[model samples]
Target: MLSSILTGIGEATQLSALVANLVGVIVGITFGSMPGLTFSTGLILLLPVTFAFDPVTGISLLVGVFIGGMTGGSVSAILLGIPGTPSAAATVIDGYPLKQKGMAGKALGMAVIASIFAGLVSLLLLILVAPLIAKVALQFGSVEIFALVLFGLSTIISVSSGSVIKGLIAGIIGLMAMEIGLDPVMGVHRFTLGYEPLQAGIDLLAAMIGLFAIPQIIKDLPRSQGETGIKIEEKGITNQLPSWQEIKSCFGIMVRGALMGTGIGSIPGTGGPIAAFLSYETNKRMSKHPEKWGTGILEGVAAPEAANNGVTGGALIPMLTLGIPGDPGTAILLGALLIHGLQPGPLLFQNNADVVYGIFAALFIANILTLIVQWFGIRLFVKILQVPKTILLPAIMVLTIVGSFAVRNNLFDVYVMAVFGVIGYFLERYDFPTTPVILAIVLGPTLETEMRRAIIAEGTYTAFFTHPISAVFIFLTLVMLFGPTVKDKIAARRAA
Candidate 1:
């Protein structure tokens, strides 16, 4: 295994693979930073173009785009309160706040550095401990996985950041939303009410688009077209590096975010957004000055950005070692692999070691190009926000249609996008937090699937706590769900 791995590594180190990886990162970043464009759609749009190139070069570049796209989403989320991808939803919380305070440059700097660092850490972990981690991932049975999903669900309280009760209510609403379709296990429809589209339930991506991108558009409108120009300004230079103190202070947060990101990302059906949300909420609550979070602290920028980027590498765990996809983006990645006549599984490392190693190497090299390109490209990116809303909004709506259509080549998704835009507008008007809603969209399926599976196998309730590993996750979920209650009591006692 070692000798073969080395040989594969050697085969993939050529300059062509390196260059393709670098260029792919740049392309991925551009597509991701644009409002309404997503990493998966970006890849889909560009995948056809890759058919003309060498397989290794083409795939390496696509991999580069996927990784870069993850990092790039934070840019718009921080700058224009627009998340370039759904994964950056958590970022928009504090990120948009910083941009509003004219600290956009500082926020962007922190996000970029944290993204690069966490990405490197996840990659290193992948290279050194992937097989070990894969073992741990397998240890997670249905009960354990369900408990983990509950752990994610338990985070809704933290992200509320305003009213815990309201957040819980919102999360419940989201879960209810998730139940709108047929029961996959039972082959029975529950909430569709006989509508053809409703039988499939609400599209998760469309719901996310509603929960995130739509609200921003409604907030920026109602002005005349001639004077509708929103001038985008760079208050400070983009190339500024964050202070050593800032980096040092955020070290623990970054590490924590990265670890958590990797763990969540390894789960099939979850994705970068969940990792980012959990990490951001956890870091914020753990901070000495939790009150300053949405007020635009550097830690706010660093935590979610690093967390999301960490998901980039971790998502590959299941995809490379097992046949399962960690997220929709990886689902698209799986398609790309199939297109190249490669099967992703335990045998992948043995069968096509060069391709796998090439991706690993590409991730490492892409980070360098990503950082350099982003540093120089930040100025131009910031300028994009200056485009007139009349022009940009229409283009965004069009992109929404195009992107949605690109997903499954279905016109229904385009309609789904339009419907969600209205839904998002009203949700924002109510001052409801979308974090929990998006979190539900993310975790709902996993939660239901795991719980049903666990219940069926155990034939008793104790199985969730019977095994040591399952017990640990269950205990953690309990703590996450109820610890805030204990904290509130302690603070009340102290105040009294």
Candidate 2:
């Protein structure tokens, strides 16, 4: 383990790795600070490019983007009262108020500090916790793995946001799409519809680009002017670092927010938005002067910023150790890992400890770089908001097409991307969550393959429940799926 850690450190410190991390951080900040351009979209657009690099370097680039984007969202939340990303929504409550009070610089400074603090804390937890989880997971058989995948699927409820039924429908659609290709075990065509390309199934990268990027472009393209209405005042914004006393005052809040973010982010489908809002609300409730929370206080900025940035490391835990993504960003990262021929799970740690440890080192470097870059380059990152959507969206569209086509150098993949883009646009238009679709697409094959293997190995369906670990996970799945409905019913009965 020590040898692998040392090797990973060596890999991460290479000149190419350093450059990729720097560029990724800059690009991530640009994407996160611009409204309607999310870091997930950035990941999708850049997914194909990573395929050309070695595993460690490519994953490092993505890690840098993930860390930087989480912090960068606070930029617009403070300056324009519009969160650049959903996770930054809570930051706007106090962040904008601080801007109004001509304390924009102070708010921005504290936000950066809080983000750095929380991010490192989450990283430490990740390093300590992930390996232990993987060690336990190493004992899982096919039945247990199948149950775990079922548990992962149950998380669709958490990501659904508004309607669980809609999320399930979307997930079913994704599962059906995966079924179009040749069966994984039997090697027989299931639903090719007489098309040769369909025999290979939908390309993951193409689907990811279409589902995440195109809808965003279609929504933002109608607005010709960008950042023209928002003005950044120069006077109060310069050299507005927070005082040492203020940082000390918010230390407790930052630590609590970090822990909350890490815990929430470790749960599949919860993501940064929930963590940020939960932390912000919890801090408000715990504060002596709750009334001052939304009125522009340092605690307010620190709470959400810490939690949201903390999610960067926390989300990676499940993705790396369990082959389960915690959020859309990590979902794309999972796809990238598969594209590079790296299967995430316990065996990955056993076989490719160097790569796994390299990722840890990369994340550590990325967080430190994020602090330095955001602290000094605030002015440059803020200017990213001014780029017109008319120009930016068109360029992104081109990237999406190119990225999809580059997957296998097939024009058919490009067509598939366009079709899914239309489907995604309508899905989003109807307020249906698209995350479950992505998750299903990523996890469906594993679920199907593992179930078959489990049944074959045990010669009965009862094996899933007979195994202790599998039974535990299956119980969790049942609770995840039906617990909320039952609780709501009981609440209604009590009210009646």
Candidate 3:
């Protein structure tokens, strides 16, 4: 294991690999700091280019992008109250409050500090535990895999705080959308709308962009013509803590958020954004000042920022160990690994130690670099919010079109994206949660593949709950699905 990790590290030090990874990190951070621009989009846009490169360098480049982008999401969320990615949404709920209270600088400071800490903790855990986890994963047959996937789905309960019903509806919609494409296991075509393009099913990227990005942009369109409606109180930047007292009080929040984010991110299908929001709500429920949560508390901003950033490394655990992506960005990383002809499972640690450790080692490097860049770059990123919408909107639109076309060079995807943008806007207005919808799109394919395999093996009605691994997963999934509903019912009954 040690030797293979060393080998992977040595491979990363090659001049070309270093250069490519640096470029990827830069590009990822740029997109991730911009609202409506996502890490998934950045990776998908670059996927076609990897066809011509060494797989090791190519894969490393994308991994750098994923790591950098995950941290970068907090920049906009903290400084401007606009989330650069869905995962950053929880950051916005509290981060913007600090900014409103004339503590934008302080908020960004806490966020940066927490993000770096969380990232390092997650990185350490990944380095120490990945090989062990992969070894355990070897025990997985179809039943275990199905159970793992089911448990991953259960995280939707953690994600949906106020409205579990809405979250379920969103999850079902995502599952239904997944059915639109071909059945991976059976070689059967499912619900294509009888169009040749529809045969490919709804493009996940296009759908995600529509659901998370377009809708938010459209909701803000009314302010597009006005002076960038975001008012910057423009307080001189302060590095002071929100309060020694507040910091001490909120220490547990950040710690809890970071740990929860790390655990959730270790599973495939979930990522930092969901972890952030879950951490935020979880912390709020435990806080003495719950009423002050959305009203601009530093703990609010700090918790999610730290938690979301922490999940970045946690997300990498499964990717590095089992070759399974824990989120969309890592999903792209998986593709990069395959293209390089490197299989990333248990043997990976035994065979590619340098690469494994080099990536792990780079975690420390990237977190340090992220803090350095963000510390000095806050002013520049915040200025983004003040950019006149007339110019910004048109520019964003053009980028949206170009970014979509860059994926497959398909016009069909472009139209799909526009339609989703409209849908996202209306849904946000109605207070429907769009985050789960995107998550569903991301997890849908994995769910389908695993469940079918489990059913095939068991060949019985009880397969879902009979296999020990599957049973554990189903138990968790049932808990996730029913826990909130029961809690809500009990709360209502008491109120009555």
Candidate 4:
């Protein structure tokens, strides 16, 4: 094992690997900081370019992008209140508020720091326990997956800003939106309304952009006439890094977030967004001052940023060990490996042990590079808040439209984005939280598909409770659903 580690370190330290990692991180930050272009999109664009390089160098580049993009999404989330990727959605809850408070630099700094810390932690897990985690992940059947998703859906209560009823209503609307496409279990279409384009349902990325970006753009339109951009404090930009005392305060939150991210990312089909939200929700529940969570707290920014970046390493575990991609980005990474004549299952580990370790070293280097780049880049990133609204709003509007269209290269998605934008605008206008809607859209398909599969396999709903893992999650879901109300009742009784 020691020799293998040495071999891997040797391969990763090569000039080609270092250059590839640096270049990928730079490109990735650009792609991720832009609303609508996700890390997966960047990987897709860069995949062909990687074909020219050796396997280790090429994979290193992709790994760098994966890490950079995961971290970079927080940039737009903090500065503009628009998540550059789904994973950064949770970050916006607190990050943008910090920006509103003229603490964009602080939020951005915390995001970068938390990202680097959690990323290394996950890398450690990947190196030490990949096979064990992969083995356990393989035990998750359809029933278990359904229960897990159900548990995730329960987080709507936490994410909902003020009113739980409004949140549930928004979630139901999101679920209804998900039903518009062809049914996951059967190929039969339900809510297409005889329109061919509707058969594909709503594009998640487009809807997200519309939900978060469009409303903000519209809100700023009137102000475009006379309003200058937000005034950022000069001190905030110059001294962006958090104090050691602040880091100490958030240490536990970051650790918990990292663990949650690693666990979720090891499971195939689950992705960074789920880890991020779960982390945010969990941290909120655990915090003594939970009421301050969405009020631009640094802990809120740390939680989701850590979890999302931690996903990078945890995701690679299943992808490398079991030939199973943990999420869309890793699926593309798996494809890149295949393109390079490198299979990712156990035999490849035996035959190409050096390459495997090299990838590990590359991931470590990528985290360090991401930290350095984002640290210095915070000063530049905060400048976005200085742009005049008259120019900024129009540019953002154009980006939203273009981004919506670019997702599937479908004009219809642009229309979908417009529709969702209007829905989001009204939802926010009425104090209805939009995060639940996003969560429902994300989890709806998985929830539907897994429930159906579980039923088909066991021929009874009771099987959900009969299975231990499923039962545990279901129990947790129940607790999540009712725990707050129960606590409130207990407190009221005591006061009485």
Q: What is the C-alpha lDDT of each candidate?
A: 0.73, 0.89, 0.71, 0.81
Could you give candidate 2's per-residue lDDT for residues 464-483 as a string of tens digits?
A: 98999999999999999999
Name the best candidate (by lDDT): 2
lDDT (Cα, tens digit) per residue for candidate 4, span 286-327: 999999999999999999999998888888886787565545
* TM-score, structure 3 vs. true: 0.73
Q: Which stretches of candidate 2 lie over 4 Å from their true place?
A: 223-235
Model 3, residue 131: C-alpha shift (Å): 2.1
| Candidate 2 clash pair list | none
**TM agreement with the true structure for every prediction:** 0.63, 0.97, 0.73, 0.62
> Order the candidates by TM-score, highest first — what do you get?
2, 3, 1, 4
Tell me model 4's lDDT, rounded to 2 decimals: 0.81
> What would the TM-score be for candidate 1 when compared with the true structure?
0.63
The candidate, 1 or 2, that scores higher on lDDT is: 2
Which one wins on TM-score? 2
lDDT assessment of candidate 2: 0.89
Quality of model 1 by C-alpha lDDT:
0.73
The weakest ten consecutive residues by lDDT in model 3 span 223-232
Tens digits of lDDT, candidate 1, 141-235: 78877776676576676557577777787778778888888885787998777878778777665555555456665665655545644355566
Candidate structures ordered by lDDT, highest first: 2, 4, 1, 3
How many clashing residue pairs are found in candidate 2? 0
